[model samples]
Target: MARQEPLVRAASAVRTVVEQGADDGYAGLEISGDRVLLWWKGAPPPAVTDTARAAGVAVEVRAAEHSREELRAAADRLWRSSGVEHGGQLQAVKIISDGRGLEAAVRPGRKSPLAPLPELGVPVDVVEQEPPTPTSRCDDGVPWYGGLAIRPSGEWGGACGGNENLRYTCTGGFGVHIGSTEYLLTAGHCATVGETLLDGAGQYIGEATLRHAEHDLVLVRTDAADRIWDGVPGVSDFTKPVVGWVWTFPGQSLCYSGATSGANCGYTVVKDEYTKFCYEGRCWSDLIAAKRKGRFSVAGGDSGGPVFSLINNSAWIQAAGTVTGTLQQTDLLGNKTEWVIFQDFGTATRDWPGLDTINYLDPM
Candidate 1:
């Protein structure tokens, strides 16, 4: 005969223990293979323990003062040692309460008192704290030459590929550096992978390290280089936008940029959507459609470019979402022809986490 499944035995044992409890006795039962766990509060009786023992079940109890980590470790050890293999995964762990277990008491730091858990009359174990927020860093800026500006750091290349002939490229955007090594942020998509992009002048300086991705941010590192100013037009103080930085909205001013477009400004038209522009690609975000008639708007090879809002005669630049264009309509002899119409469209920093990760201090 096949070996008996431990989970089935555990379930049966748990059912037996629950049946022996009085109407107001055992709070609940948790089963894991041949092991049965029961919860109770405000003083449990010996009869509950006796019933569990009769069913060949090991009892692991908890109290409010007990840490969650301690209880979890004990449960893990018990499951391993019981010789039971199936269904040992814990579903949930909760502290049983009778509605009057929380009492407020004041402490030192503030005006509010500390609220501790009241005595639950059960065994509680210590628990571990949640993980910390990830970070990345790049103290010095990257170098730029010709039309290509190389930053010494960037997040992992999630999906990076380019076509030289067509001049189109897409890099799963990564987190940008804000400050020291400890505080870094990046786009959520970039952080999914563990990698970075690097470029150095005379030496191989540093590499891009991904801290976390949920906010679409990454941190990179380099030599302890002081921040430098190139005094170029349109390059806002990385420390802060000039003043009055508003997101793209209807009738609001906007601009498009990239290594190719140079930098052209426009006005906003539409606001939000997964819009389809040139090349049949769809971009999703709060759309900032521009209404400026310029020689060149957004073009290929401009993903992850910065979009700026012109407010109070100052330029406040932020990462524009994605750049797209439209298809132009041409008329010929009672027929209409479709052609690629390149325009500027993008999302604003207000909709992304880029602005929150850094403090815009006066230019240093």
Candidate 2:
């Protein structure tokens, strides 16, 4: 049997009426069920009314500044007259007018029935909620992990091609003192040959002296030094210690970081061989996996953000790895691939066959 195309009727009917000696305005159209709704910025010409009559569409007119209730009443009447018993498929034509311009949208009807109106005399005002803080306590001290908190200082190009200026954004991943003075770790991609890191004030901090492209790890050096801590701390007198290494394990609780989403704590889903294909090299392997679920989380701009673990009373801690991949899925079980992987200092040296000779970082 031949199938028929589903009907796509207009959401509402519209007609325009213009005031004499005023410029005639145009109407916006929206579709809902079999009806087409019309909205206009100013009074429309009588021609608009003739056009609607020709199309056999009903028309409703309201002042440009009609209240929500007033608009709803008109729509309800139109919906009832149209014989649309269920409100779910109802559509509305909305119009807004400023002296200079007009805008319109065709909106689907409310999914659910409107809730009972609030008490008539009650005062109401909308309030926005503040975001939760991302810092947490660990053995070393408190650390900033999540949110779009990383601020860029300055940028230089010339890494990928001939004098190509690469815009560098400032992040917390570069020159992170893991354990040893010789092995500074950061996002591999960030350590491009011609790139540099800048501070919040746009001062040059370090140069991308070394990089592991496959694992996306970079190593750099700077004159500044500070003691790294594990947990979130208030103002204190404890001298900050330099972190050389971080201990991590499978299923250990840890935090994932990025510039925009900030930090989120998730367990190590897996710590096995993670093979990553690079844009210019063979597949790389052996990366850590950190997973978390929260409203504020990681995204693309956070590629080299650090993943940290707190353990042993927050006394012993080290960098587990860097974020490399993110996965998107249509189902909860993630049966499909939506993964984003990052290269870290250790993984880059370990996986890339030629990286050790090129960048001087020892194999993990």
Candidate 3:
């Protein structure tokens, strides 16, 4: 990250100067290698050109053919068709204003695309990088995934599921009930359909009945109902028992529990923008951002853990959702920070139709 920090700082400085002329022709900025890339139209004015050169960082300026607004619209069009399901070739899709117009920054899949990249209506910028390791899956040496209990979110279930010769460990968050059936919620990457799950003590707990990689969620058939809602800790000793949930507001505080880092108490919902979580080229799209000031919002083995907000000084909590993955830091400071990206369980219920209840926390 030694090369990344200077780019971030330089980007901040450049963004201030360029975005001012976005109405004129400044398209956008991107970091490629060790330099900051700026896309703009026409020749630079002395005042603006001098400010950019004085930024004290490496910079690359390109002549953009289209206006910023036109490029933005093109990016939005690509974003809309990202999930059209062309044999899952699109691992991730991001809009970047390029010198020509817009570039769809895509993480290509292992398999080839059924359709051509030009069909997306934007130029495809294939990113070359290694996929993330399966940190949340059950491993023989690491036992960092857990916290199945409702009240304390303590360590109990993690690293579950098995094939003929492989047994993996992963955290199973609190329980949920729909009509007469109960299920354990966790990340889909933890286990596949038909795989059996185990607890921390290696006890048989459930079977993986449902998994949606796009949402990074799995539903395990289990008898572990929601336990007592004794309540989660709050700021300044303001504790409240979680009774129900409300939709996420912009500036609320959200927390989560997991095995590696145990209980992560304080994190602010600083961003609520769309996010992406990819695993080994495969991806789970349509996520939101949850961030804390200092430390990471989540680490390995923390996947599938519940994200909730304490209400008032009481246990009335907002049922946010489960942790998905981390977001790439997009600033110039090279300040690598962790962002706990999650999908709202409230919005997720639409996928599970005919269900009597969805994401309802069990009472003690």
Candidate 4:
């Protein structure tokens, strides 16, 4: 865990420079095994490199083809022009972490006219890939912790509108406080505002108070605590206290839990600021992508579960993000794997200012 401090300090310095609009040609930043890699389109900025060095960390500046801002603009233009074309064939779009170019994922065997899009100033690398689908999960308990299964009230065990389809379930995310109101976090696509959430045993959990469909995040005002279930339901029941939240860096290790899949680890961060096209022609952006190592780490009904990393190999944990869905990507060997994608808590706090996980920092 101590190895993360230098990476954190270096990231802070780079973030400060970008936030201040003094990034120069900065493209992105990543933590690669205790070293900070800063990608820039042209000459590396002395300000950011010097600041990061002064923070007592090793920093490497690499040349990039395009800046993050440029890639984002290019991606937006491509989406605007080709999002609804060919029945929404475009699956996803993101800036290559190494700043090589923009990556546009389209449905396999489908033709998309993405190359001639006007105002797409940056280079685009098109690939055939399937779009990710939203997943939703569980446990039993009080003070309602994250990773517990929750479903819409009145639809959990029954069919709605004369169909045998039961309501889809979702896993609770982190417990957060917006002002004095306590709320449980979950995937917005799981339920709508004003819908009452219930546990598997038919107990009232809370009512969805806030929903952000674009980011796939929802807040439920309820009785909750700042902890995540550490054990799998029907097997064991334990929890770890949430100390605070942390930003996700590529190559960092993480673990996630859901009612359907329980807890799975050995996941590595792959990318951030990804925009995935989902059902109903919608696209959710600013998502973090983590690759699974072994057996599937995510499945249907795992949406809104907690994604975190252990702190100092102890029971305490730092909040990372909330599961959104899984993406299918092919490797150089042409092997396809389902990757767990999540909405970063950092984006959550930014979207809802003053929002924070109910943690040890709170008053007793």
The model with the greatest TM-score is 4
Candidate 2 lDDT over 1-364, as tens digits, reads: 0010011111112211221222343323333234444445556566666556565444444333332233334433433432123222222121121111111111223333433323322122211111111111111112222111122234432111111232223234523432333323456544475566553234455566666654556665544332222222222213222233232322334554444344445443332223222222222333444444433344444556556543334432334466654534334764432233444334543443322211113212
**Per the 3 Å backbone cut-off, how many clashing residue pairs does candidate 3 have?**
14
Off by over 4 Å in 1: 1-192, 199-245, 275-288, 315-364
Angstrom error of the Cα, residue 310, model 1: value is 2.1
What TM-score does each of the candidates earn?
A: 0.34, 0.41, 0.54, 0.86
TM-score of model 4 (CA atoms): 0.86
Candidate order by lDDT, highest to lowest? 4, 3, 2, 1
Q: Which stretches of candidate 3 lie over 4 Å from their true place?
A: 1-91, 94-146, 149-168, 227-242, 270-272, 312-316, 328-336, 354-364
Give one digit per residue, the lDDT tens place, for model 4 in 174-203: 889988889999888888999999876667
lDDT at position 318, candidate 2: 35
Clashes of 2: 61
Model 1, 329: alpha-carbon shift in Å?
6.5
Clashing pairs in 4: 135-303, 136-301, 136-302, 136-303, 137-301, 138-148, 138-149, 138-259
Which numbered prediction scores highest in lDDT against the true structure? 4
Estimate the lDDT of model 4: 0.74
